[model samples]
Target: MAKFPKNFLWGGATSANQIEGTFLEQGKGWSTADIDKFIPKEQRKSGPADNLVKRADVEFAMHDKKGIYPKRNGIDFYHHYKEDIALLAEAGFKMFRISISWPRIFPNGDDKEPNEEGLRFYDKVFDECRKKKIEPLVTLSHFEMPLNLVLKQNGWLSRKTVDDFVHYADVVFNRYKNKVRYWITFNEINVLEMSGFTSGGILADNIANRKEARYQAAHHQFVASALAVKKCHEIIPNASIGAMIARFESYPKTCNPKDALANVRANQNNLFFSDVQIRGYYPSYIKRFFKDNDIHLKINDGDKKILREGTADFLAFSYYSSMVAISPDATEGEKLTSGNLKLSFQNPYLRSNDWGWQFDPIGLRIALNELYDRYQVPLFVVENGLGAKDKLSKDNRIHDDYRIDYLKQHIEQIGEAYQDGVEIMGYLIWGCIDLVSASSCEMSKRYGIVYVDLDDYGKGTLKRKKKDSYYWYKKVVESNGLIL
Candidate 1:
């Protein structure tokens, strides 16, 4: 058995939008997540497209009164933190990664003062973690940006949002300076390109030039992230802030030079966010991308200095599967898998989950090496897990050996990566407790060691049950990856 370092963090990852319900409770305003309607599996598509009709449908659904808004009542985590944290402590969690909802604190994104009730809520949550000897890995913004920002300021597309985000960061950094040492500026900042509205609150469908709007919004987010890093360091002593990206490792479809070149460009395009956040500057390759796409980024004078000075302390990312990129002339009709907010060509060598996400534990090892070699910084696997449909047996036990096997394989790969000289900080499985799915917005796409008794239509007992993998994971954590 490969042994991890003594201080390696073992826990799970969840975001406020996915898990923390009470969207309109305790002075919290509506977030973009609050307005995101549940799209049926058949209605989903490969990539983002400009559709004003769909955007209007979403807006209409927001006020339809009978529309099913799943996020509005996320696993009811607002009322179950103590119970959930106790379960996590039982699993021997050394650290727990969760996001602080922007709207929860600010109500509106441009607020002069934060809501006291929202502040007190996290105060109790963080204090509970302290009681259980669990360190909280906090993300400043997770997809739950206040909808007010999007409506009033056009989301991150406008430079004014940079100051609003900084104000929110300043408040939280000062308040939780002592509780949280591990901070992430943004969750999957790279998703701003594909899912601009959900990730950064830029409504791609509403913009005339979708590419220009998305890239401009991404630049604003980059500056905001850098400013947050600077503020986090200034306010919180001994804080280590990182940038989180959705990592989609790509491989050439074949040995053809065109395929290889296409793969390289795809990887570079996906890696653009980390390049700026970690390397402290934009890559030169983006110049070609900008010119070819007719995209012009609006940059201010001191923005460069801010980005240079606020390089992230480390790099954290979520890796679910690897993708295969082919040349434009390559044949179609290949099997497809969903991941990282994009549809990718399925790898014939890998298995897949019910959600059509490819299973590739070895890809994790490959990703760790590539990221480490590129930046030479400590890497944290903050989100990695299988989303499956589990059945409650007659004996009231979830015999989810499949889930255990999935995690076991991934952890073993992490061990291999560690032996290969990667500086891995931790492995936090996605959704320690069952919560709403971020992409599908369905509770049925379950991924958790501790299962929550919630149905897809938001009707269940809300009971917490431990699956077989829960005990298995507890043992793995207690042994620090040796038991697996």
Candidate 2:
């Protein structure tokens, strides 16, 4: 096997809310996830509604609670950062992709002054990563917004949220400007529209009207992202700031041109966030889509200038599986929803993960090739992994050959993309440790190479057990490629 670039990043990915679970500890107040206690259902208000059992679920059920579901303490990454980082280091990670909790930093979304305790927590976290000589790629916002800001100011639907986001980003950039080099302004910024308020951590009632609210909220975020990019350069002139999008591999449902056209349109819209961020402007197709739909955005003075000047240095995205989108007239069948997309199981031919994200390793190569052709910027795959249900035998060993198979095939495609002149930056698999799933907020959808014993009901000791994939991944990373 050939070696990857001398400095290529090989790491696992995680988010503050999903892994670091001191939701209200230290100076941290209730974030948007904490405010979810009143949402009444799962999937929240964004792409999919998710009722992640609040603290009340751990004791007395709330009015909108769905029985006694798992409590919000996910995998205890907040308390276990050192142990987990050691595991990641053992896997030979050159870099570690992680995000900071907004509420942890700001406590309140609109706060100009950051909480010293909140900032200090990350000080330790990043310092630990740097101690291990692992580069830290930090995300400013990852689906977590302070609830007070959302309820009081009406969330991202208002332009005020954009300014608040800039302030929030500034707080972290100034503190960790020297420690972290790679910064992603938003995580899956486009999903705020596809899944509606659910993806952005905003409540459904806050949306008021789903369609209009989605477009309006996304408009605010796009501008906010542009401003973040611009401010990042001002603060850390040499920082590599990129926009993170959930890049889906779109496939046509049929050989017919009609199906092909529909598939292309879907990809264009689904992947259009990058067009705006990378190109620093909306694409022609996006303008046409808005005109045809009569969806107008609230663009103010200098917003275009911010986007144009704040274009990202590169593109970092998450790819788990491809979706087969059919045209309106084509013969419709089941949809693939098993792997990471977790939409609906509409495609019948493909197999999927327990959570319904379709499994397609070939899609990774296609996604890489396509992004290179269109954007012509360096690409970094920040998140890609298989989430499954792993069982522990009496001997306490987990035989997770399924996960090894999934990663092996994807690594093969990564090799193909690298050899094909894709200028691939790095590959960070999702949930290096067994953390909560961002979609359903469940532990059953396991993605970690190292397994955690906790379940959806929150039973068992939060033990970290190395699965079979752990040893396999260590070798893969040590070799800089798959050993096969």
Candidate 3:
């Protein structure tokens, strides 16, 4: 049996938009995430909002050029941050992973100077974390891209966006150079391949030449990420820069070689993005797939060098489920693909979240071993949790044994991987509090160890209540692992 280092980090993770509700406060400009709440839930193809967005209206006329109705306010995280952070601190989180909203810093996307007001917002948050002695792991871009840039430049489709993104990174790195350290250039670099909204902040349903656009967009992000890493090291010499990938551990349906082949293909599709970020070039399989699909990326010579020179210091992955890849067979009753996986309910044995993410703890060990073997870089479990529905008892306590079970089993696997010689930094649970869900925007699919009472219908108190998992997690962090 092996043990994690005594100083190994244990904590929770969240994005700015999902948790920081002061969407348009303190002179903050409207980000792409802010506009998303105004859009209808079903129209949110990538990640639909549950109940928060619908009841978010607070009656203020925007007086747009088209004279449209004003948008609603978010959960008001700006003011409630102190309360929330205290809860996380009480839960024994040694590290807190959060993204800094770029629009808040540079309102119109490209700016000669960052807003002092916006910079101060993060300073306060960081100061609070420092007070609690919690290490801050910041992601430069995590789903929240400036709206003006996305609409004007088609997000990463234009090369100029890459340069602009690097500028944003430079500004942030310089601002927090001495204080906050761990940096992730881009969150889930491959998400842009699947969902343009997530990848590029684009909401348009009509995407002209989507495959070409996705690859091109991804190409720009890869370059931007590399540039950010290079600039961050310059600003902060000892920065441990990493690239976060949304790793969905895939499995074959059966022992058949054909079924296993499908799983390999699925894994390749997911890994195509990481291969470039970590390996510094496109994989042969991806190149061939692009050729067959007529998807071409415009990469300059400088971009190649940037990628090669600034590879990720570590790999951060968000593991939610283990998807079974099934081969198309006339005899096999059914199969699961991206489109049909939600409706098919293919696997009955595995447990699923309210958002339909399969809960698999063994998948963590499998993913860690695979990643360690391939990249040989230290692995960080950036995001992993079970999104469930929790009810507060009359005694004002929320009992979330489900969340406890979910994280405990996952943490057990982390220990197992350590025994297997996989170098791991820490485990950051998805949401420390009930924040917006990435898949289904509904707050009902809550992931936080601390339960926020406010619901979709807007009836309950906006109080921070500790769930059973809170105490369980506190013990895990104090014990350094699940000794109990």
Best by TM-score: 1
Task: State the lDDT at 284 in candidate 2.
Answer: 82
Model 1 misplaced regions, further than 4 Å: 42-58
RMSD (Å) per prediction = 1.6, 3.6, 4.4
Candidate 2 lDDT by residue in tens digits, 1-484: 4457766788989988778877478888666554323222363453433422223332242234564323246677878999999888888899899888888877778777888998888999999999988999998888778766755765787788888888888778888888988999888877776655445544465333455667777878888888888888889988999988888777777798987998889788778888888998877887787777677777888888888988888899998877776777655554334434336435666676665567788888889999999899999999999888888878889888989899888888888888888888999989988887776667877889988888776676888989989999899889888474
TM-score of 2: 0.91
> Taking the tens digit of each residue's C-alpha lDDT, what string does model 1 give over 23-107?
6899998788887677677876655332222346546756878767899889888999999999999999999998999898999
- In model 3, the clashing pairs are 48-441, 50-441, 50-442
Clashes of each: 0, 32, 3
- Which tens-of-lDDT digit does each residue in 255-286 have in candidate 3? 99988888888889888888888888878888
Runs in model 3 with CA error above 4 Å? 38-74, 203-206, 329-345, 457-460
CA lDDT for candidate 3: 0.76
Q: TM-scores for all candidates?
A: 0.97, 0.91, 0.90
